[model samples]
Target: MSRKKYILIFFVIILLCLSLVSYSNTTIGRVLRFGPANANDYLEFPYHEISTTSTYFKFGEANLENIVKSRFYDVTYGNNQKVGDLDQFLEDTDTTSFIVIYKDNIIYEKYYNNYNRESIVTSFSISKSFTSALIGIAIDEGYIKSVYDPITDYLPELKKRDPRFSNIKIIDLLHMSSGVSYKEPPDDIYTYFAPDLRKLALEKTQVVEDPGNSFLYNNYNPLFLGMIIERSTGKTVSEYLEEKIWKPIGMEFDGSWSIDANDFEKMESGINCRAIDFAKFGRLYLRKGNWNGKQIISTGWSVASTAPYGPENNEYYPNIPIFKEYPGYYSLMWWGIRRDDKNYDFYAAGNHGQYIYVSPEKNLIIVRNGISYGKGMESEDMSWWPIIFYQFANQFPSE
Candidate 1:
């Protein structure tokens, strides 16, 4: 070896070490460590378990005589029409679990890629819907005064830091219009992998615009909501969920919620549960928050949470229609699509193709969990899943 070459190599090693030391505790460091988020992330992170009750609610099985062995739907591309079946499409699209329930009966259920009834998949952003439900429950139980209450009521530290934060209401958070200054890649990665979420949420969140000015799809909204739920109920978000919804609904299996290093629930995402159990949540909303005649969540809140808000009220991208001809909407963390017949079908969607789609007009619920949001479709067309669900729902009679 040459002396000058050896010295150059040593300098490179020192530079690399300095870079690692500089970025170790930053969002960039976490992203480099964990990589991109995926469906099975619960296995890689620390989480708190949510247990189910002794009595479980079971769905009626469809009669073998009426069971669908093969199903097909039509698809077209560039003037060519092709026939696509449910099973093949799901398999090709990297779907892990797919379930269709009608009138409280399991009509169609399929698991692919080594996933089965017992496998657990992370809920991703679908956890936001669960957070919204907990907030409603807190209000119903008097732990929260009202949706109109300023968020500062529960998180007064924000007001102490910036008085403008007092103008942000709980409803603004629910609507994803809190005006919290957040940009993707940076803000998102920080919230997802930050070891101490409460500190990041309080210290990093800043009011960039008025509270109710417009919809911005801020991840910080749910973080603040989680903190509010914790403060108001005097319990962790996971504890509140267990007492209010998990045990009451009689989940078939124990689920888990991912937590930061400080043990705070990741309210923006990170719920892990079986696909069948996830379907139960859809069924609960399908029955208008009535779980077998038990009013778990208020009907008013149920309707308000899923129903569409006028486009004039901060209904922007992703909430808006993917295609101009069809209509779409968002309300309280749930996504909605207005059918041509003037009826609405709403869903809870997450990153990487996790969904719980509900069609009230047809009395149907479809649950989908996937690995990569499928490979064949363009990125912008990801919302097309609900349309496929709508086509599937149309095959059934309206109840």
Candidate 2:
């Protein structure tokens, strides 16, 4: 063989070996193969299945479905522009599934991109909200004494690493104000793909600010909460979720939560289930954590999670561009926007545009799942969704 041919063969062999090394099970391997995170990433990672109750609760169809299909309001430039067809706009935005519930009825539900009612989509950071709810349930069940309890009380090993850990309260984690040093590129990516998440959490968490002093939206907060839940409840977060919330409220389908190599649930993210089931979670919060007549989580917790705050609490909200124009707020992992009536509309948002939005006064709930955040009027930080939701909900006649 010629010298050039031999060199080419050698390089090709080396490339093949590297590809085989990262072909599966590792974060880099998945990213190289599947590209960035998407709505269907549940298939990429090992997960723990959360079984459903024998009896399931399903939303009833409204007399008139797709009631708000005419126009989509655009508030990009602070003006309402009646856009084109609503369905087409959703398609243009890469929406995989969109649902609307009013008066506990499925008023409008549509699936796109080969997705349907039975399709499974990943929750991304929306799982953080679920983690927050679990904390409230843990407290109610007496497994956890109180939110004021230092997290080290549950994960005492953290105190051994740093005595300052004793100062971080459970509420600090719930509020994303635990002062854990976190950055999106390295920290977020590392936690998402770390082979041993529990170790990374316990060893790598370094306090940058005093607890409850500022909001960083650190993913590590939920991760630590997952550890706390496991220690306090003597069950995995997935198990607690299945028993405390899922089965009790009658989730229609069995869900799953992603886990690391050691089998710890990735509490920062990784909930996977159907869009309708996602709406059920929204309904739970909308009705003040009550399912039918059963109180799943205390009404006080439900109210406090979504309630609005004054500008004084602005630091607690995500430091995003949209907050400059809209009084956007974050409380206990839930995002909110102050309405003109001084009421607040809250929602759970995740990466790549997963949302479970609820308006308490309107008795409305909306769920959105997407492959990617399709073309919108503004960036992800300055989303047009709040306006779209407000306009759509207002179209209905007064109760």
Candidate 3:
């Protein structure tokens, strides 16, 4: 044999060895900060009755495939200029699906290379906001008494152990002001990847600030809230959500939940749904939890969740660390923005570019889904996409 051929074979053997080791070490499960068991092992909730039977919108017979492919609205001047150039945008950023909905109709929906509209995309932290909507529905149904009630009232297991949590109101969790000692932007990567996120969240031995006095963005707030919902309502968050929200809204696809080591739904980030289903959620919020005059989530609670409450005295929650430099607002699970002389725009955003942007004034909803696992700060900022989307919003000539 030739010496060159022998050297090439030796390099290939070494590469195979490294690949095998990497595959063996990596766990076969969804990545979570902390949890005892792999997420896939979690038990799924039984399918509930879909409320679409009585609703005017029919999914099974609709030409959904053709609808997604056709252009329903004229691109805005700004979007028009950038339409042909979106390849550069996608290349520069991690974008999976980009869609635009106007006046309860889909105008433009496109998936990335090797992706399609039917692909089930993970919502990351965007699921938190959806969970908030579920909580609102539970309140409307009288399953939950009120947001002011102590969490212990619903989940007695949390009482007496943590004094700070003793009086923590349900609203406080929604506001991300539970006074729990949590490090945002995570100081230690290993600690963030623990198996039991619930234990880590509540086990924080110290209370740095009084509950409701300060605002801190942490996953613990939502995860804890999910537990409270399940304990109070005697149903998993996914079960309650399907019955109360998804089925009613006529969501066409089945969504999955990310489970913890104990097989509990993570609730903070484990939501996965199709792009159209996500748009349906955006539309539901756009209608203030109403679908054709049917009250899905109480309109009053819907308004409250998206509206701001804080000492900042601003109509929207300010001082979120991720968007500190940017002019944005946080309300419950949604992010609000006030553009120059434009209407108040709010959205449900997740890490790595998952977004459900809604403009009530224009009756427009835009959903962008992406897979940005290790892109760092740029994914969190989402600075460029919003700017591009706002420009897209301007394209529709005012009626």
The candidate that wins on TM-score is 2
Q: Weakest 10 consecutive residues, lDDT, candidate 2?
A: 71-80
| Tens-digit lDDT string for candidate 3 (250-361) | 7776777766555466666667777778888888888888987899988898887776443554423334433464456677778776554545667888766778888777
Candidates 1 and 3 compared: the better one by lDDT is 1
What lDDT score is found at residue 178 in candidate 1?
89
Judge candidate 2 against the unseen true structure and give its global Cα lDDT, from 0 to 1: 0.83
Q: Candidate 1: where are CA atoms >4 Å away? A: 1-26, 63-71, 75-83, 311-320, 323-325, 340-342
Candidate 3: C-alpha lDDT: 0.65
Winner by lDDT:
1
User: What TM-score would you give candidate 2 relative to the actual structure?
Assistant: 0.92
Per-residue C-alpha lDDT of model 2 across residues 304-344, encoded as one tens digit per residue: 87786433654655667656667676788898887666567
Order by TM-score, highest first: 2, 1, 3
**Looking at model 3, how many pairs of residues clash?**
8
Model 2 residue runs over 4 Å out of place are 1-10, 23-35, 71-82, 310-319, 340-342, 377-380, 397-399
- The C-alpha TM-scores of every prediction are 0.91, 0.92, 0.75
- Per-model C-alpha lDDT, please? 0.83, 0.83, 0.65
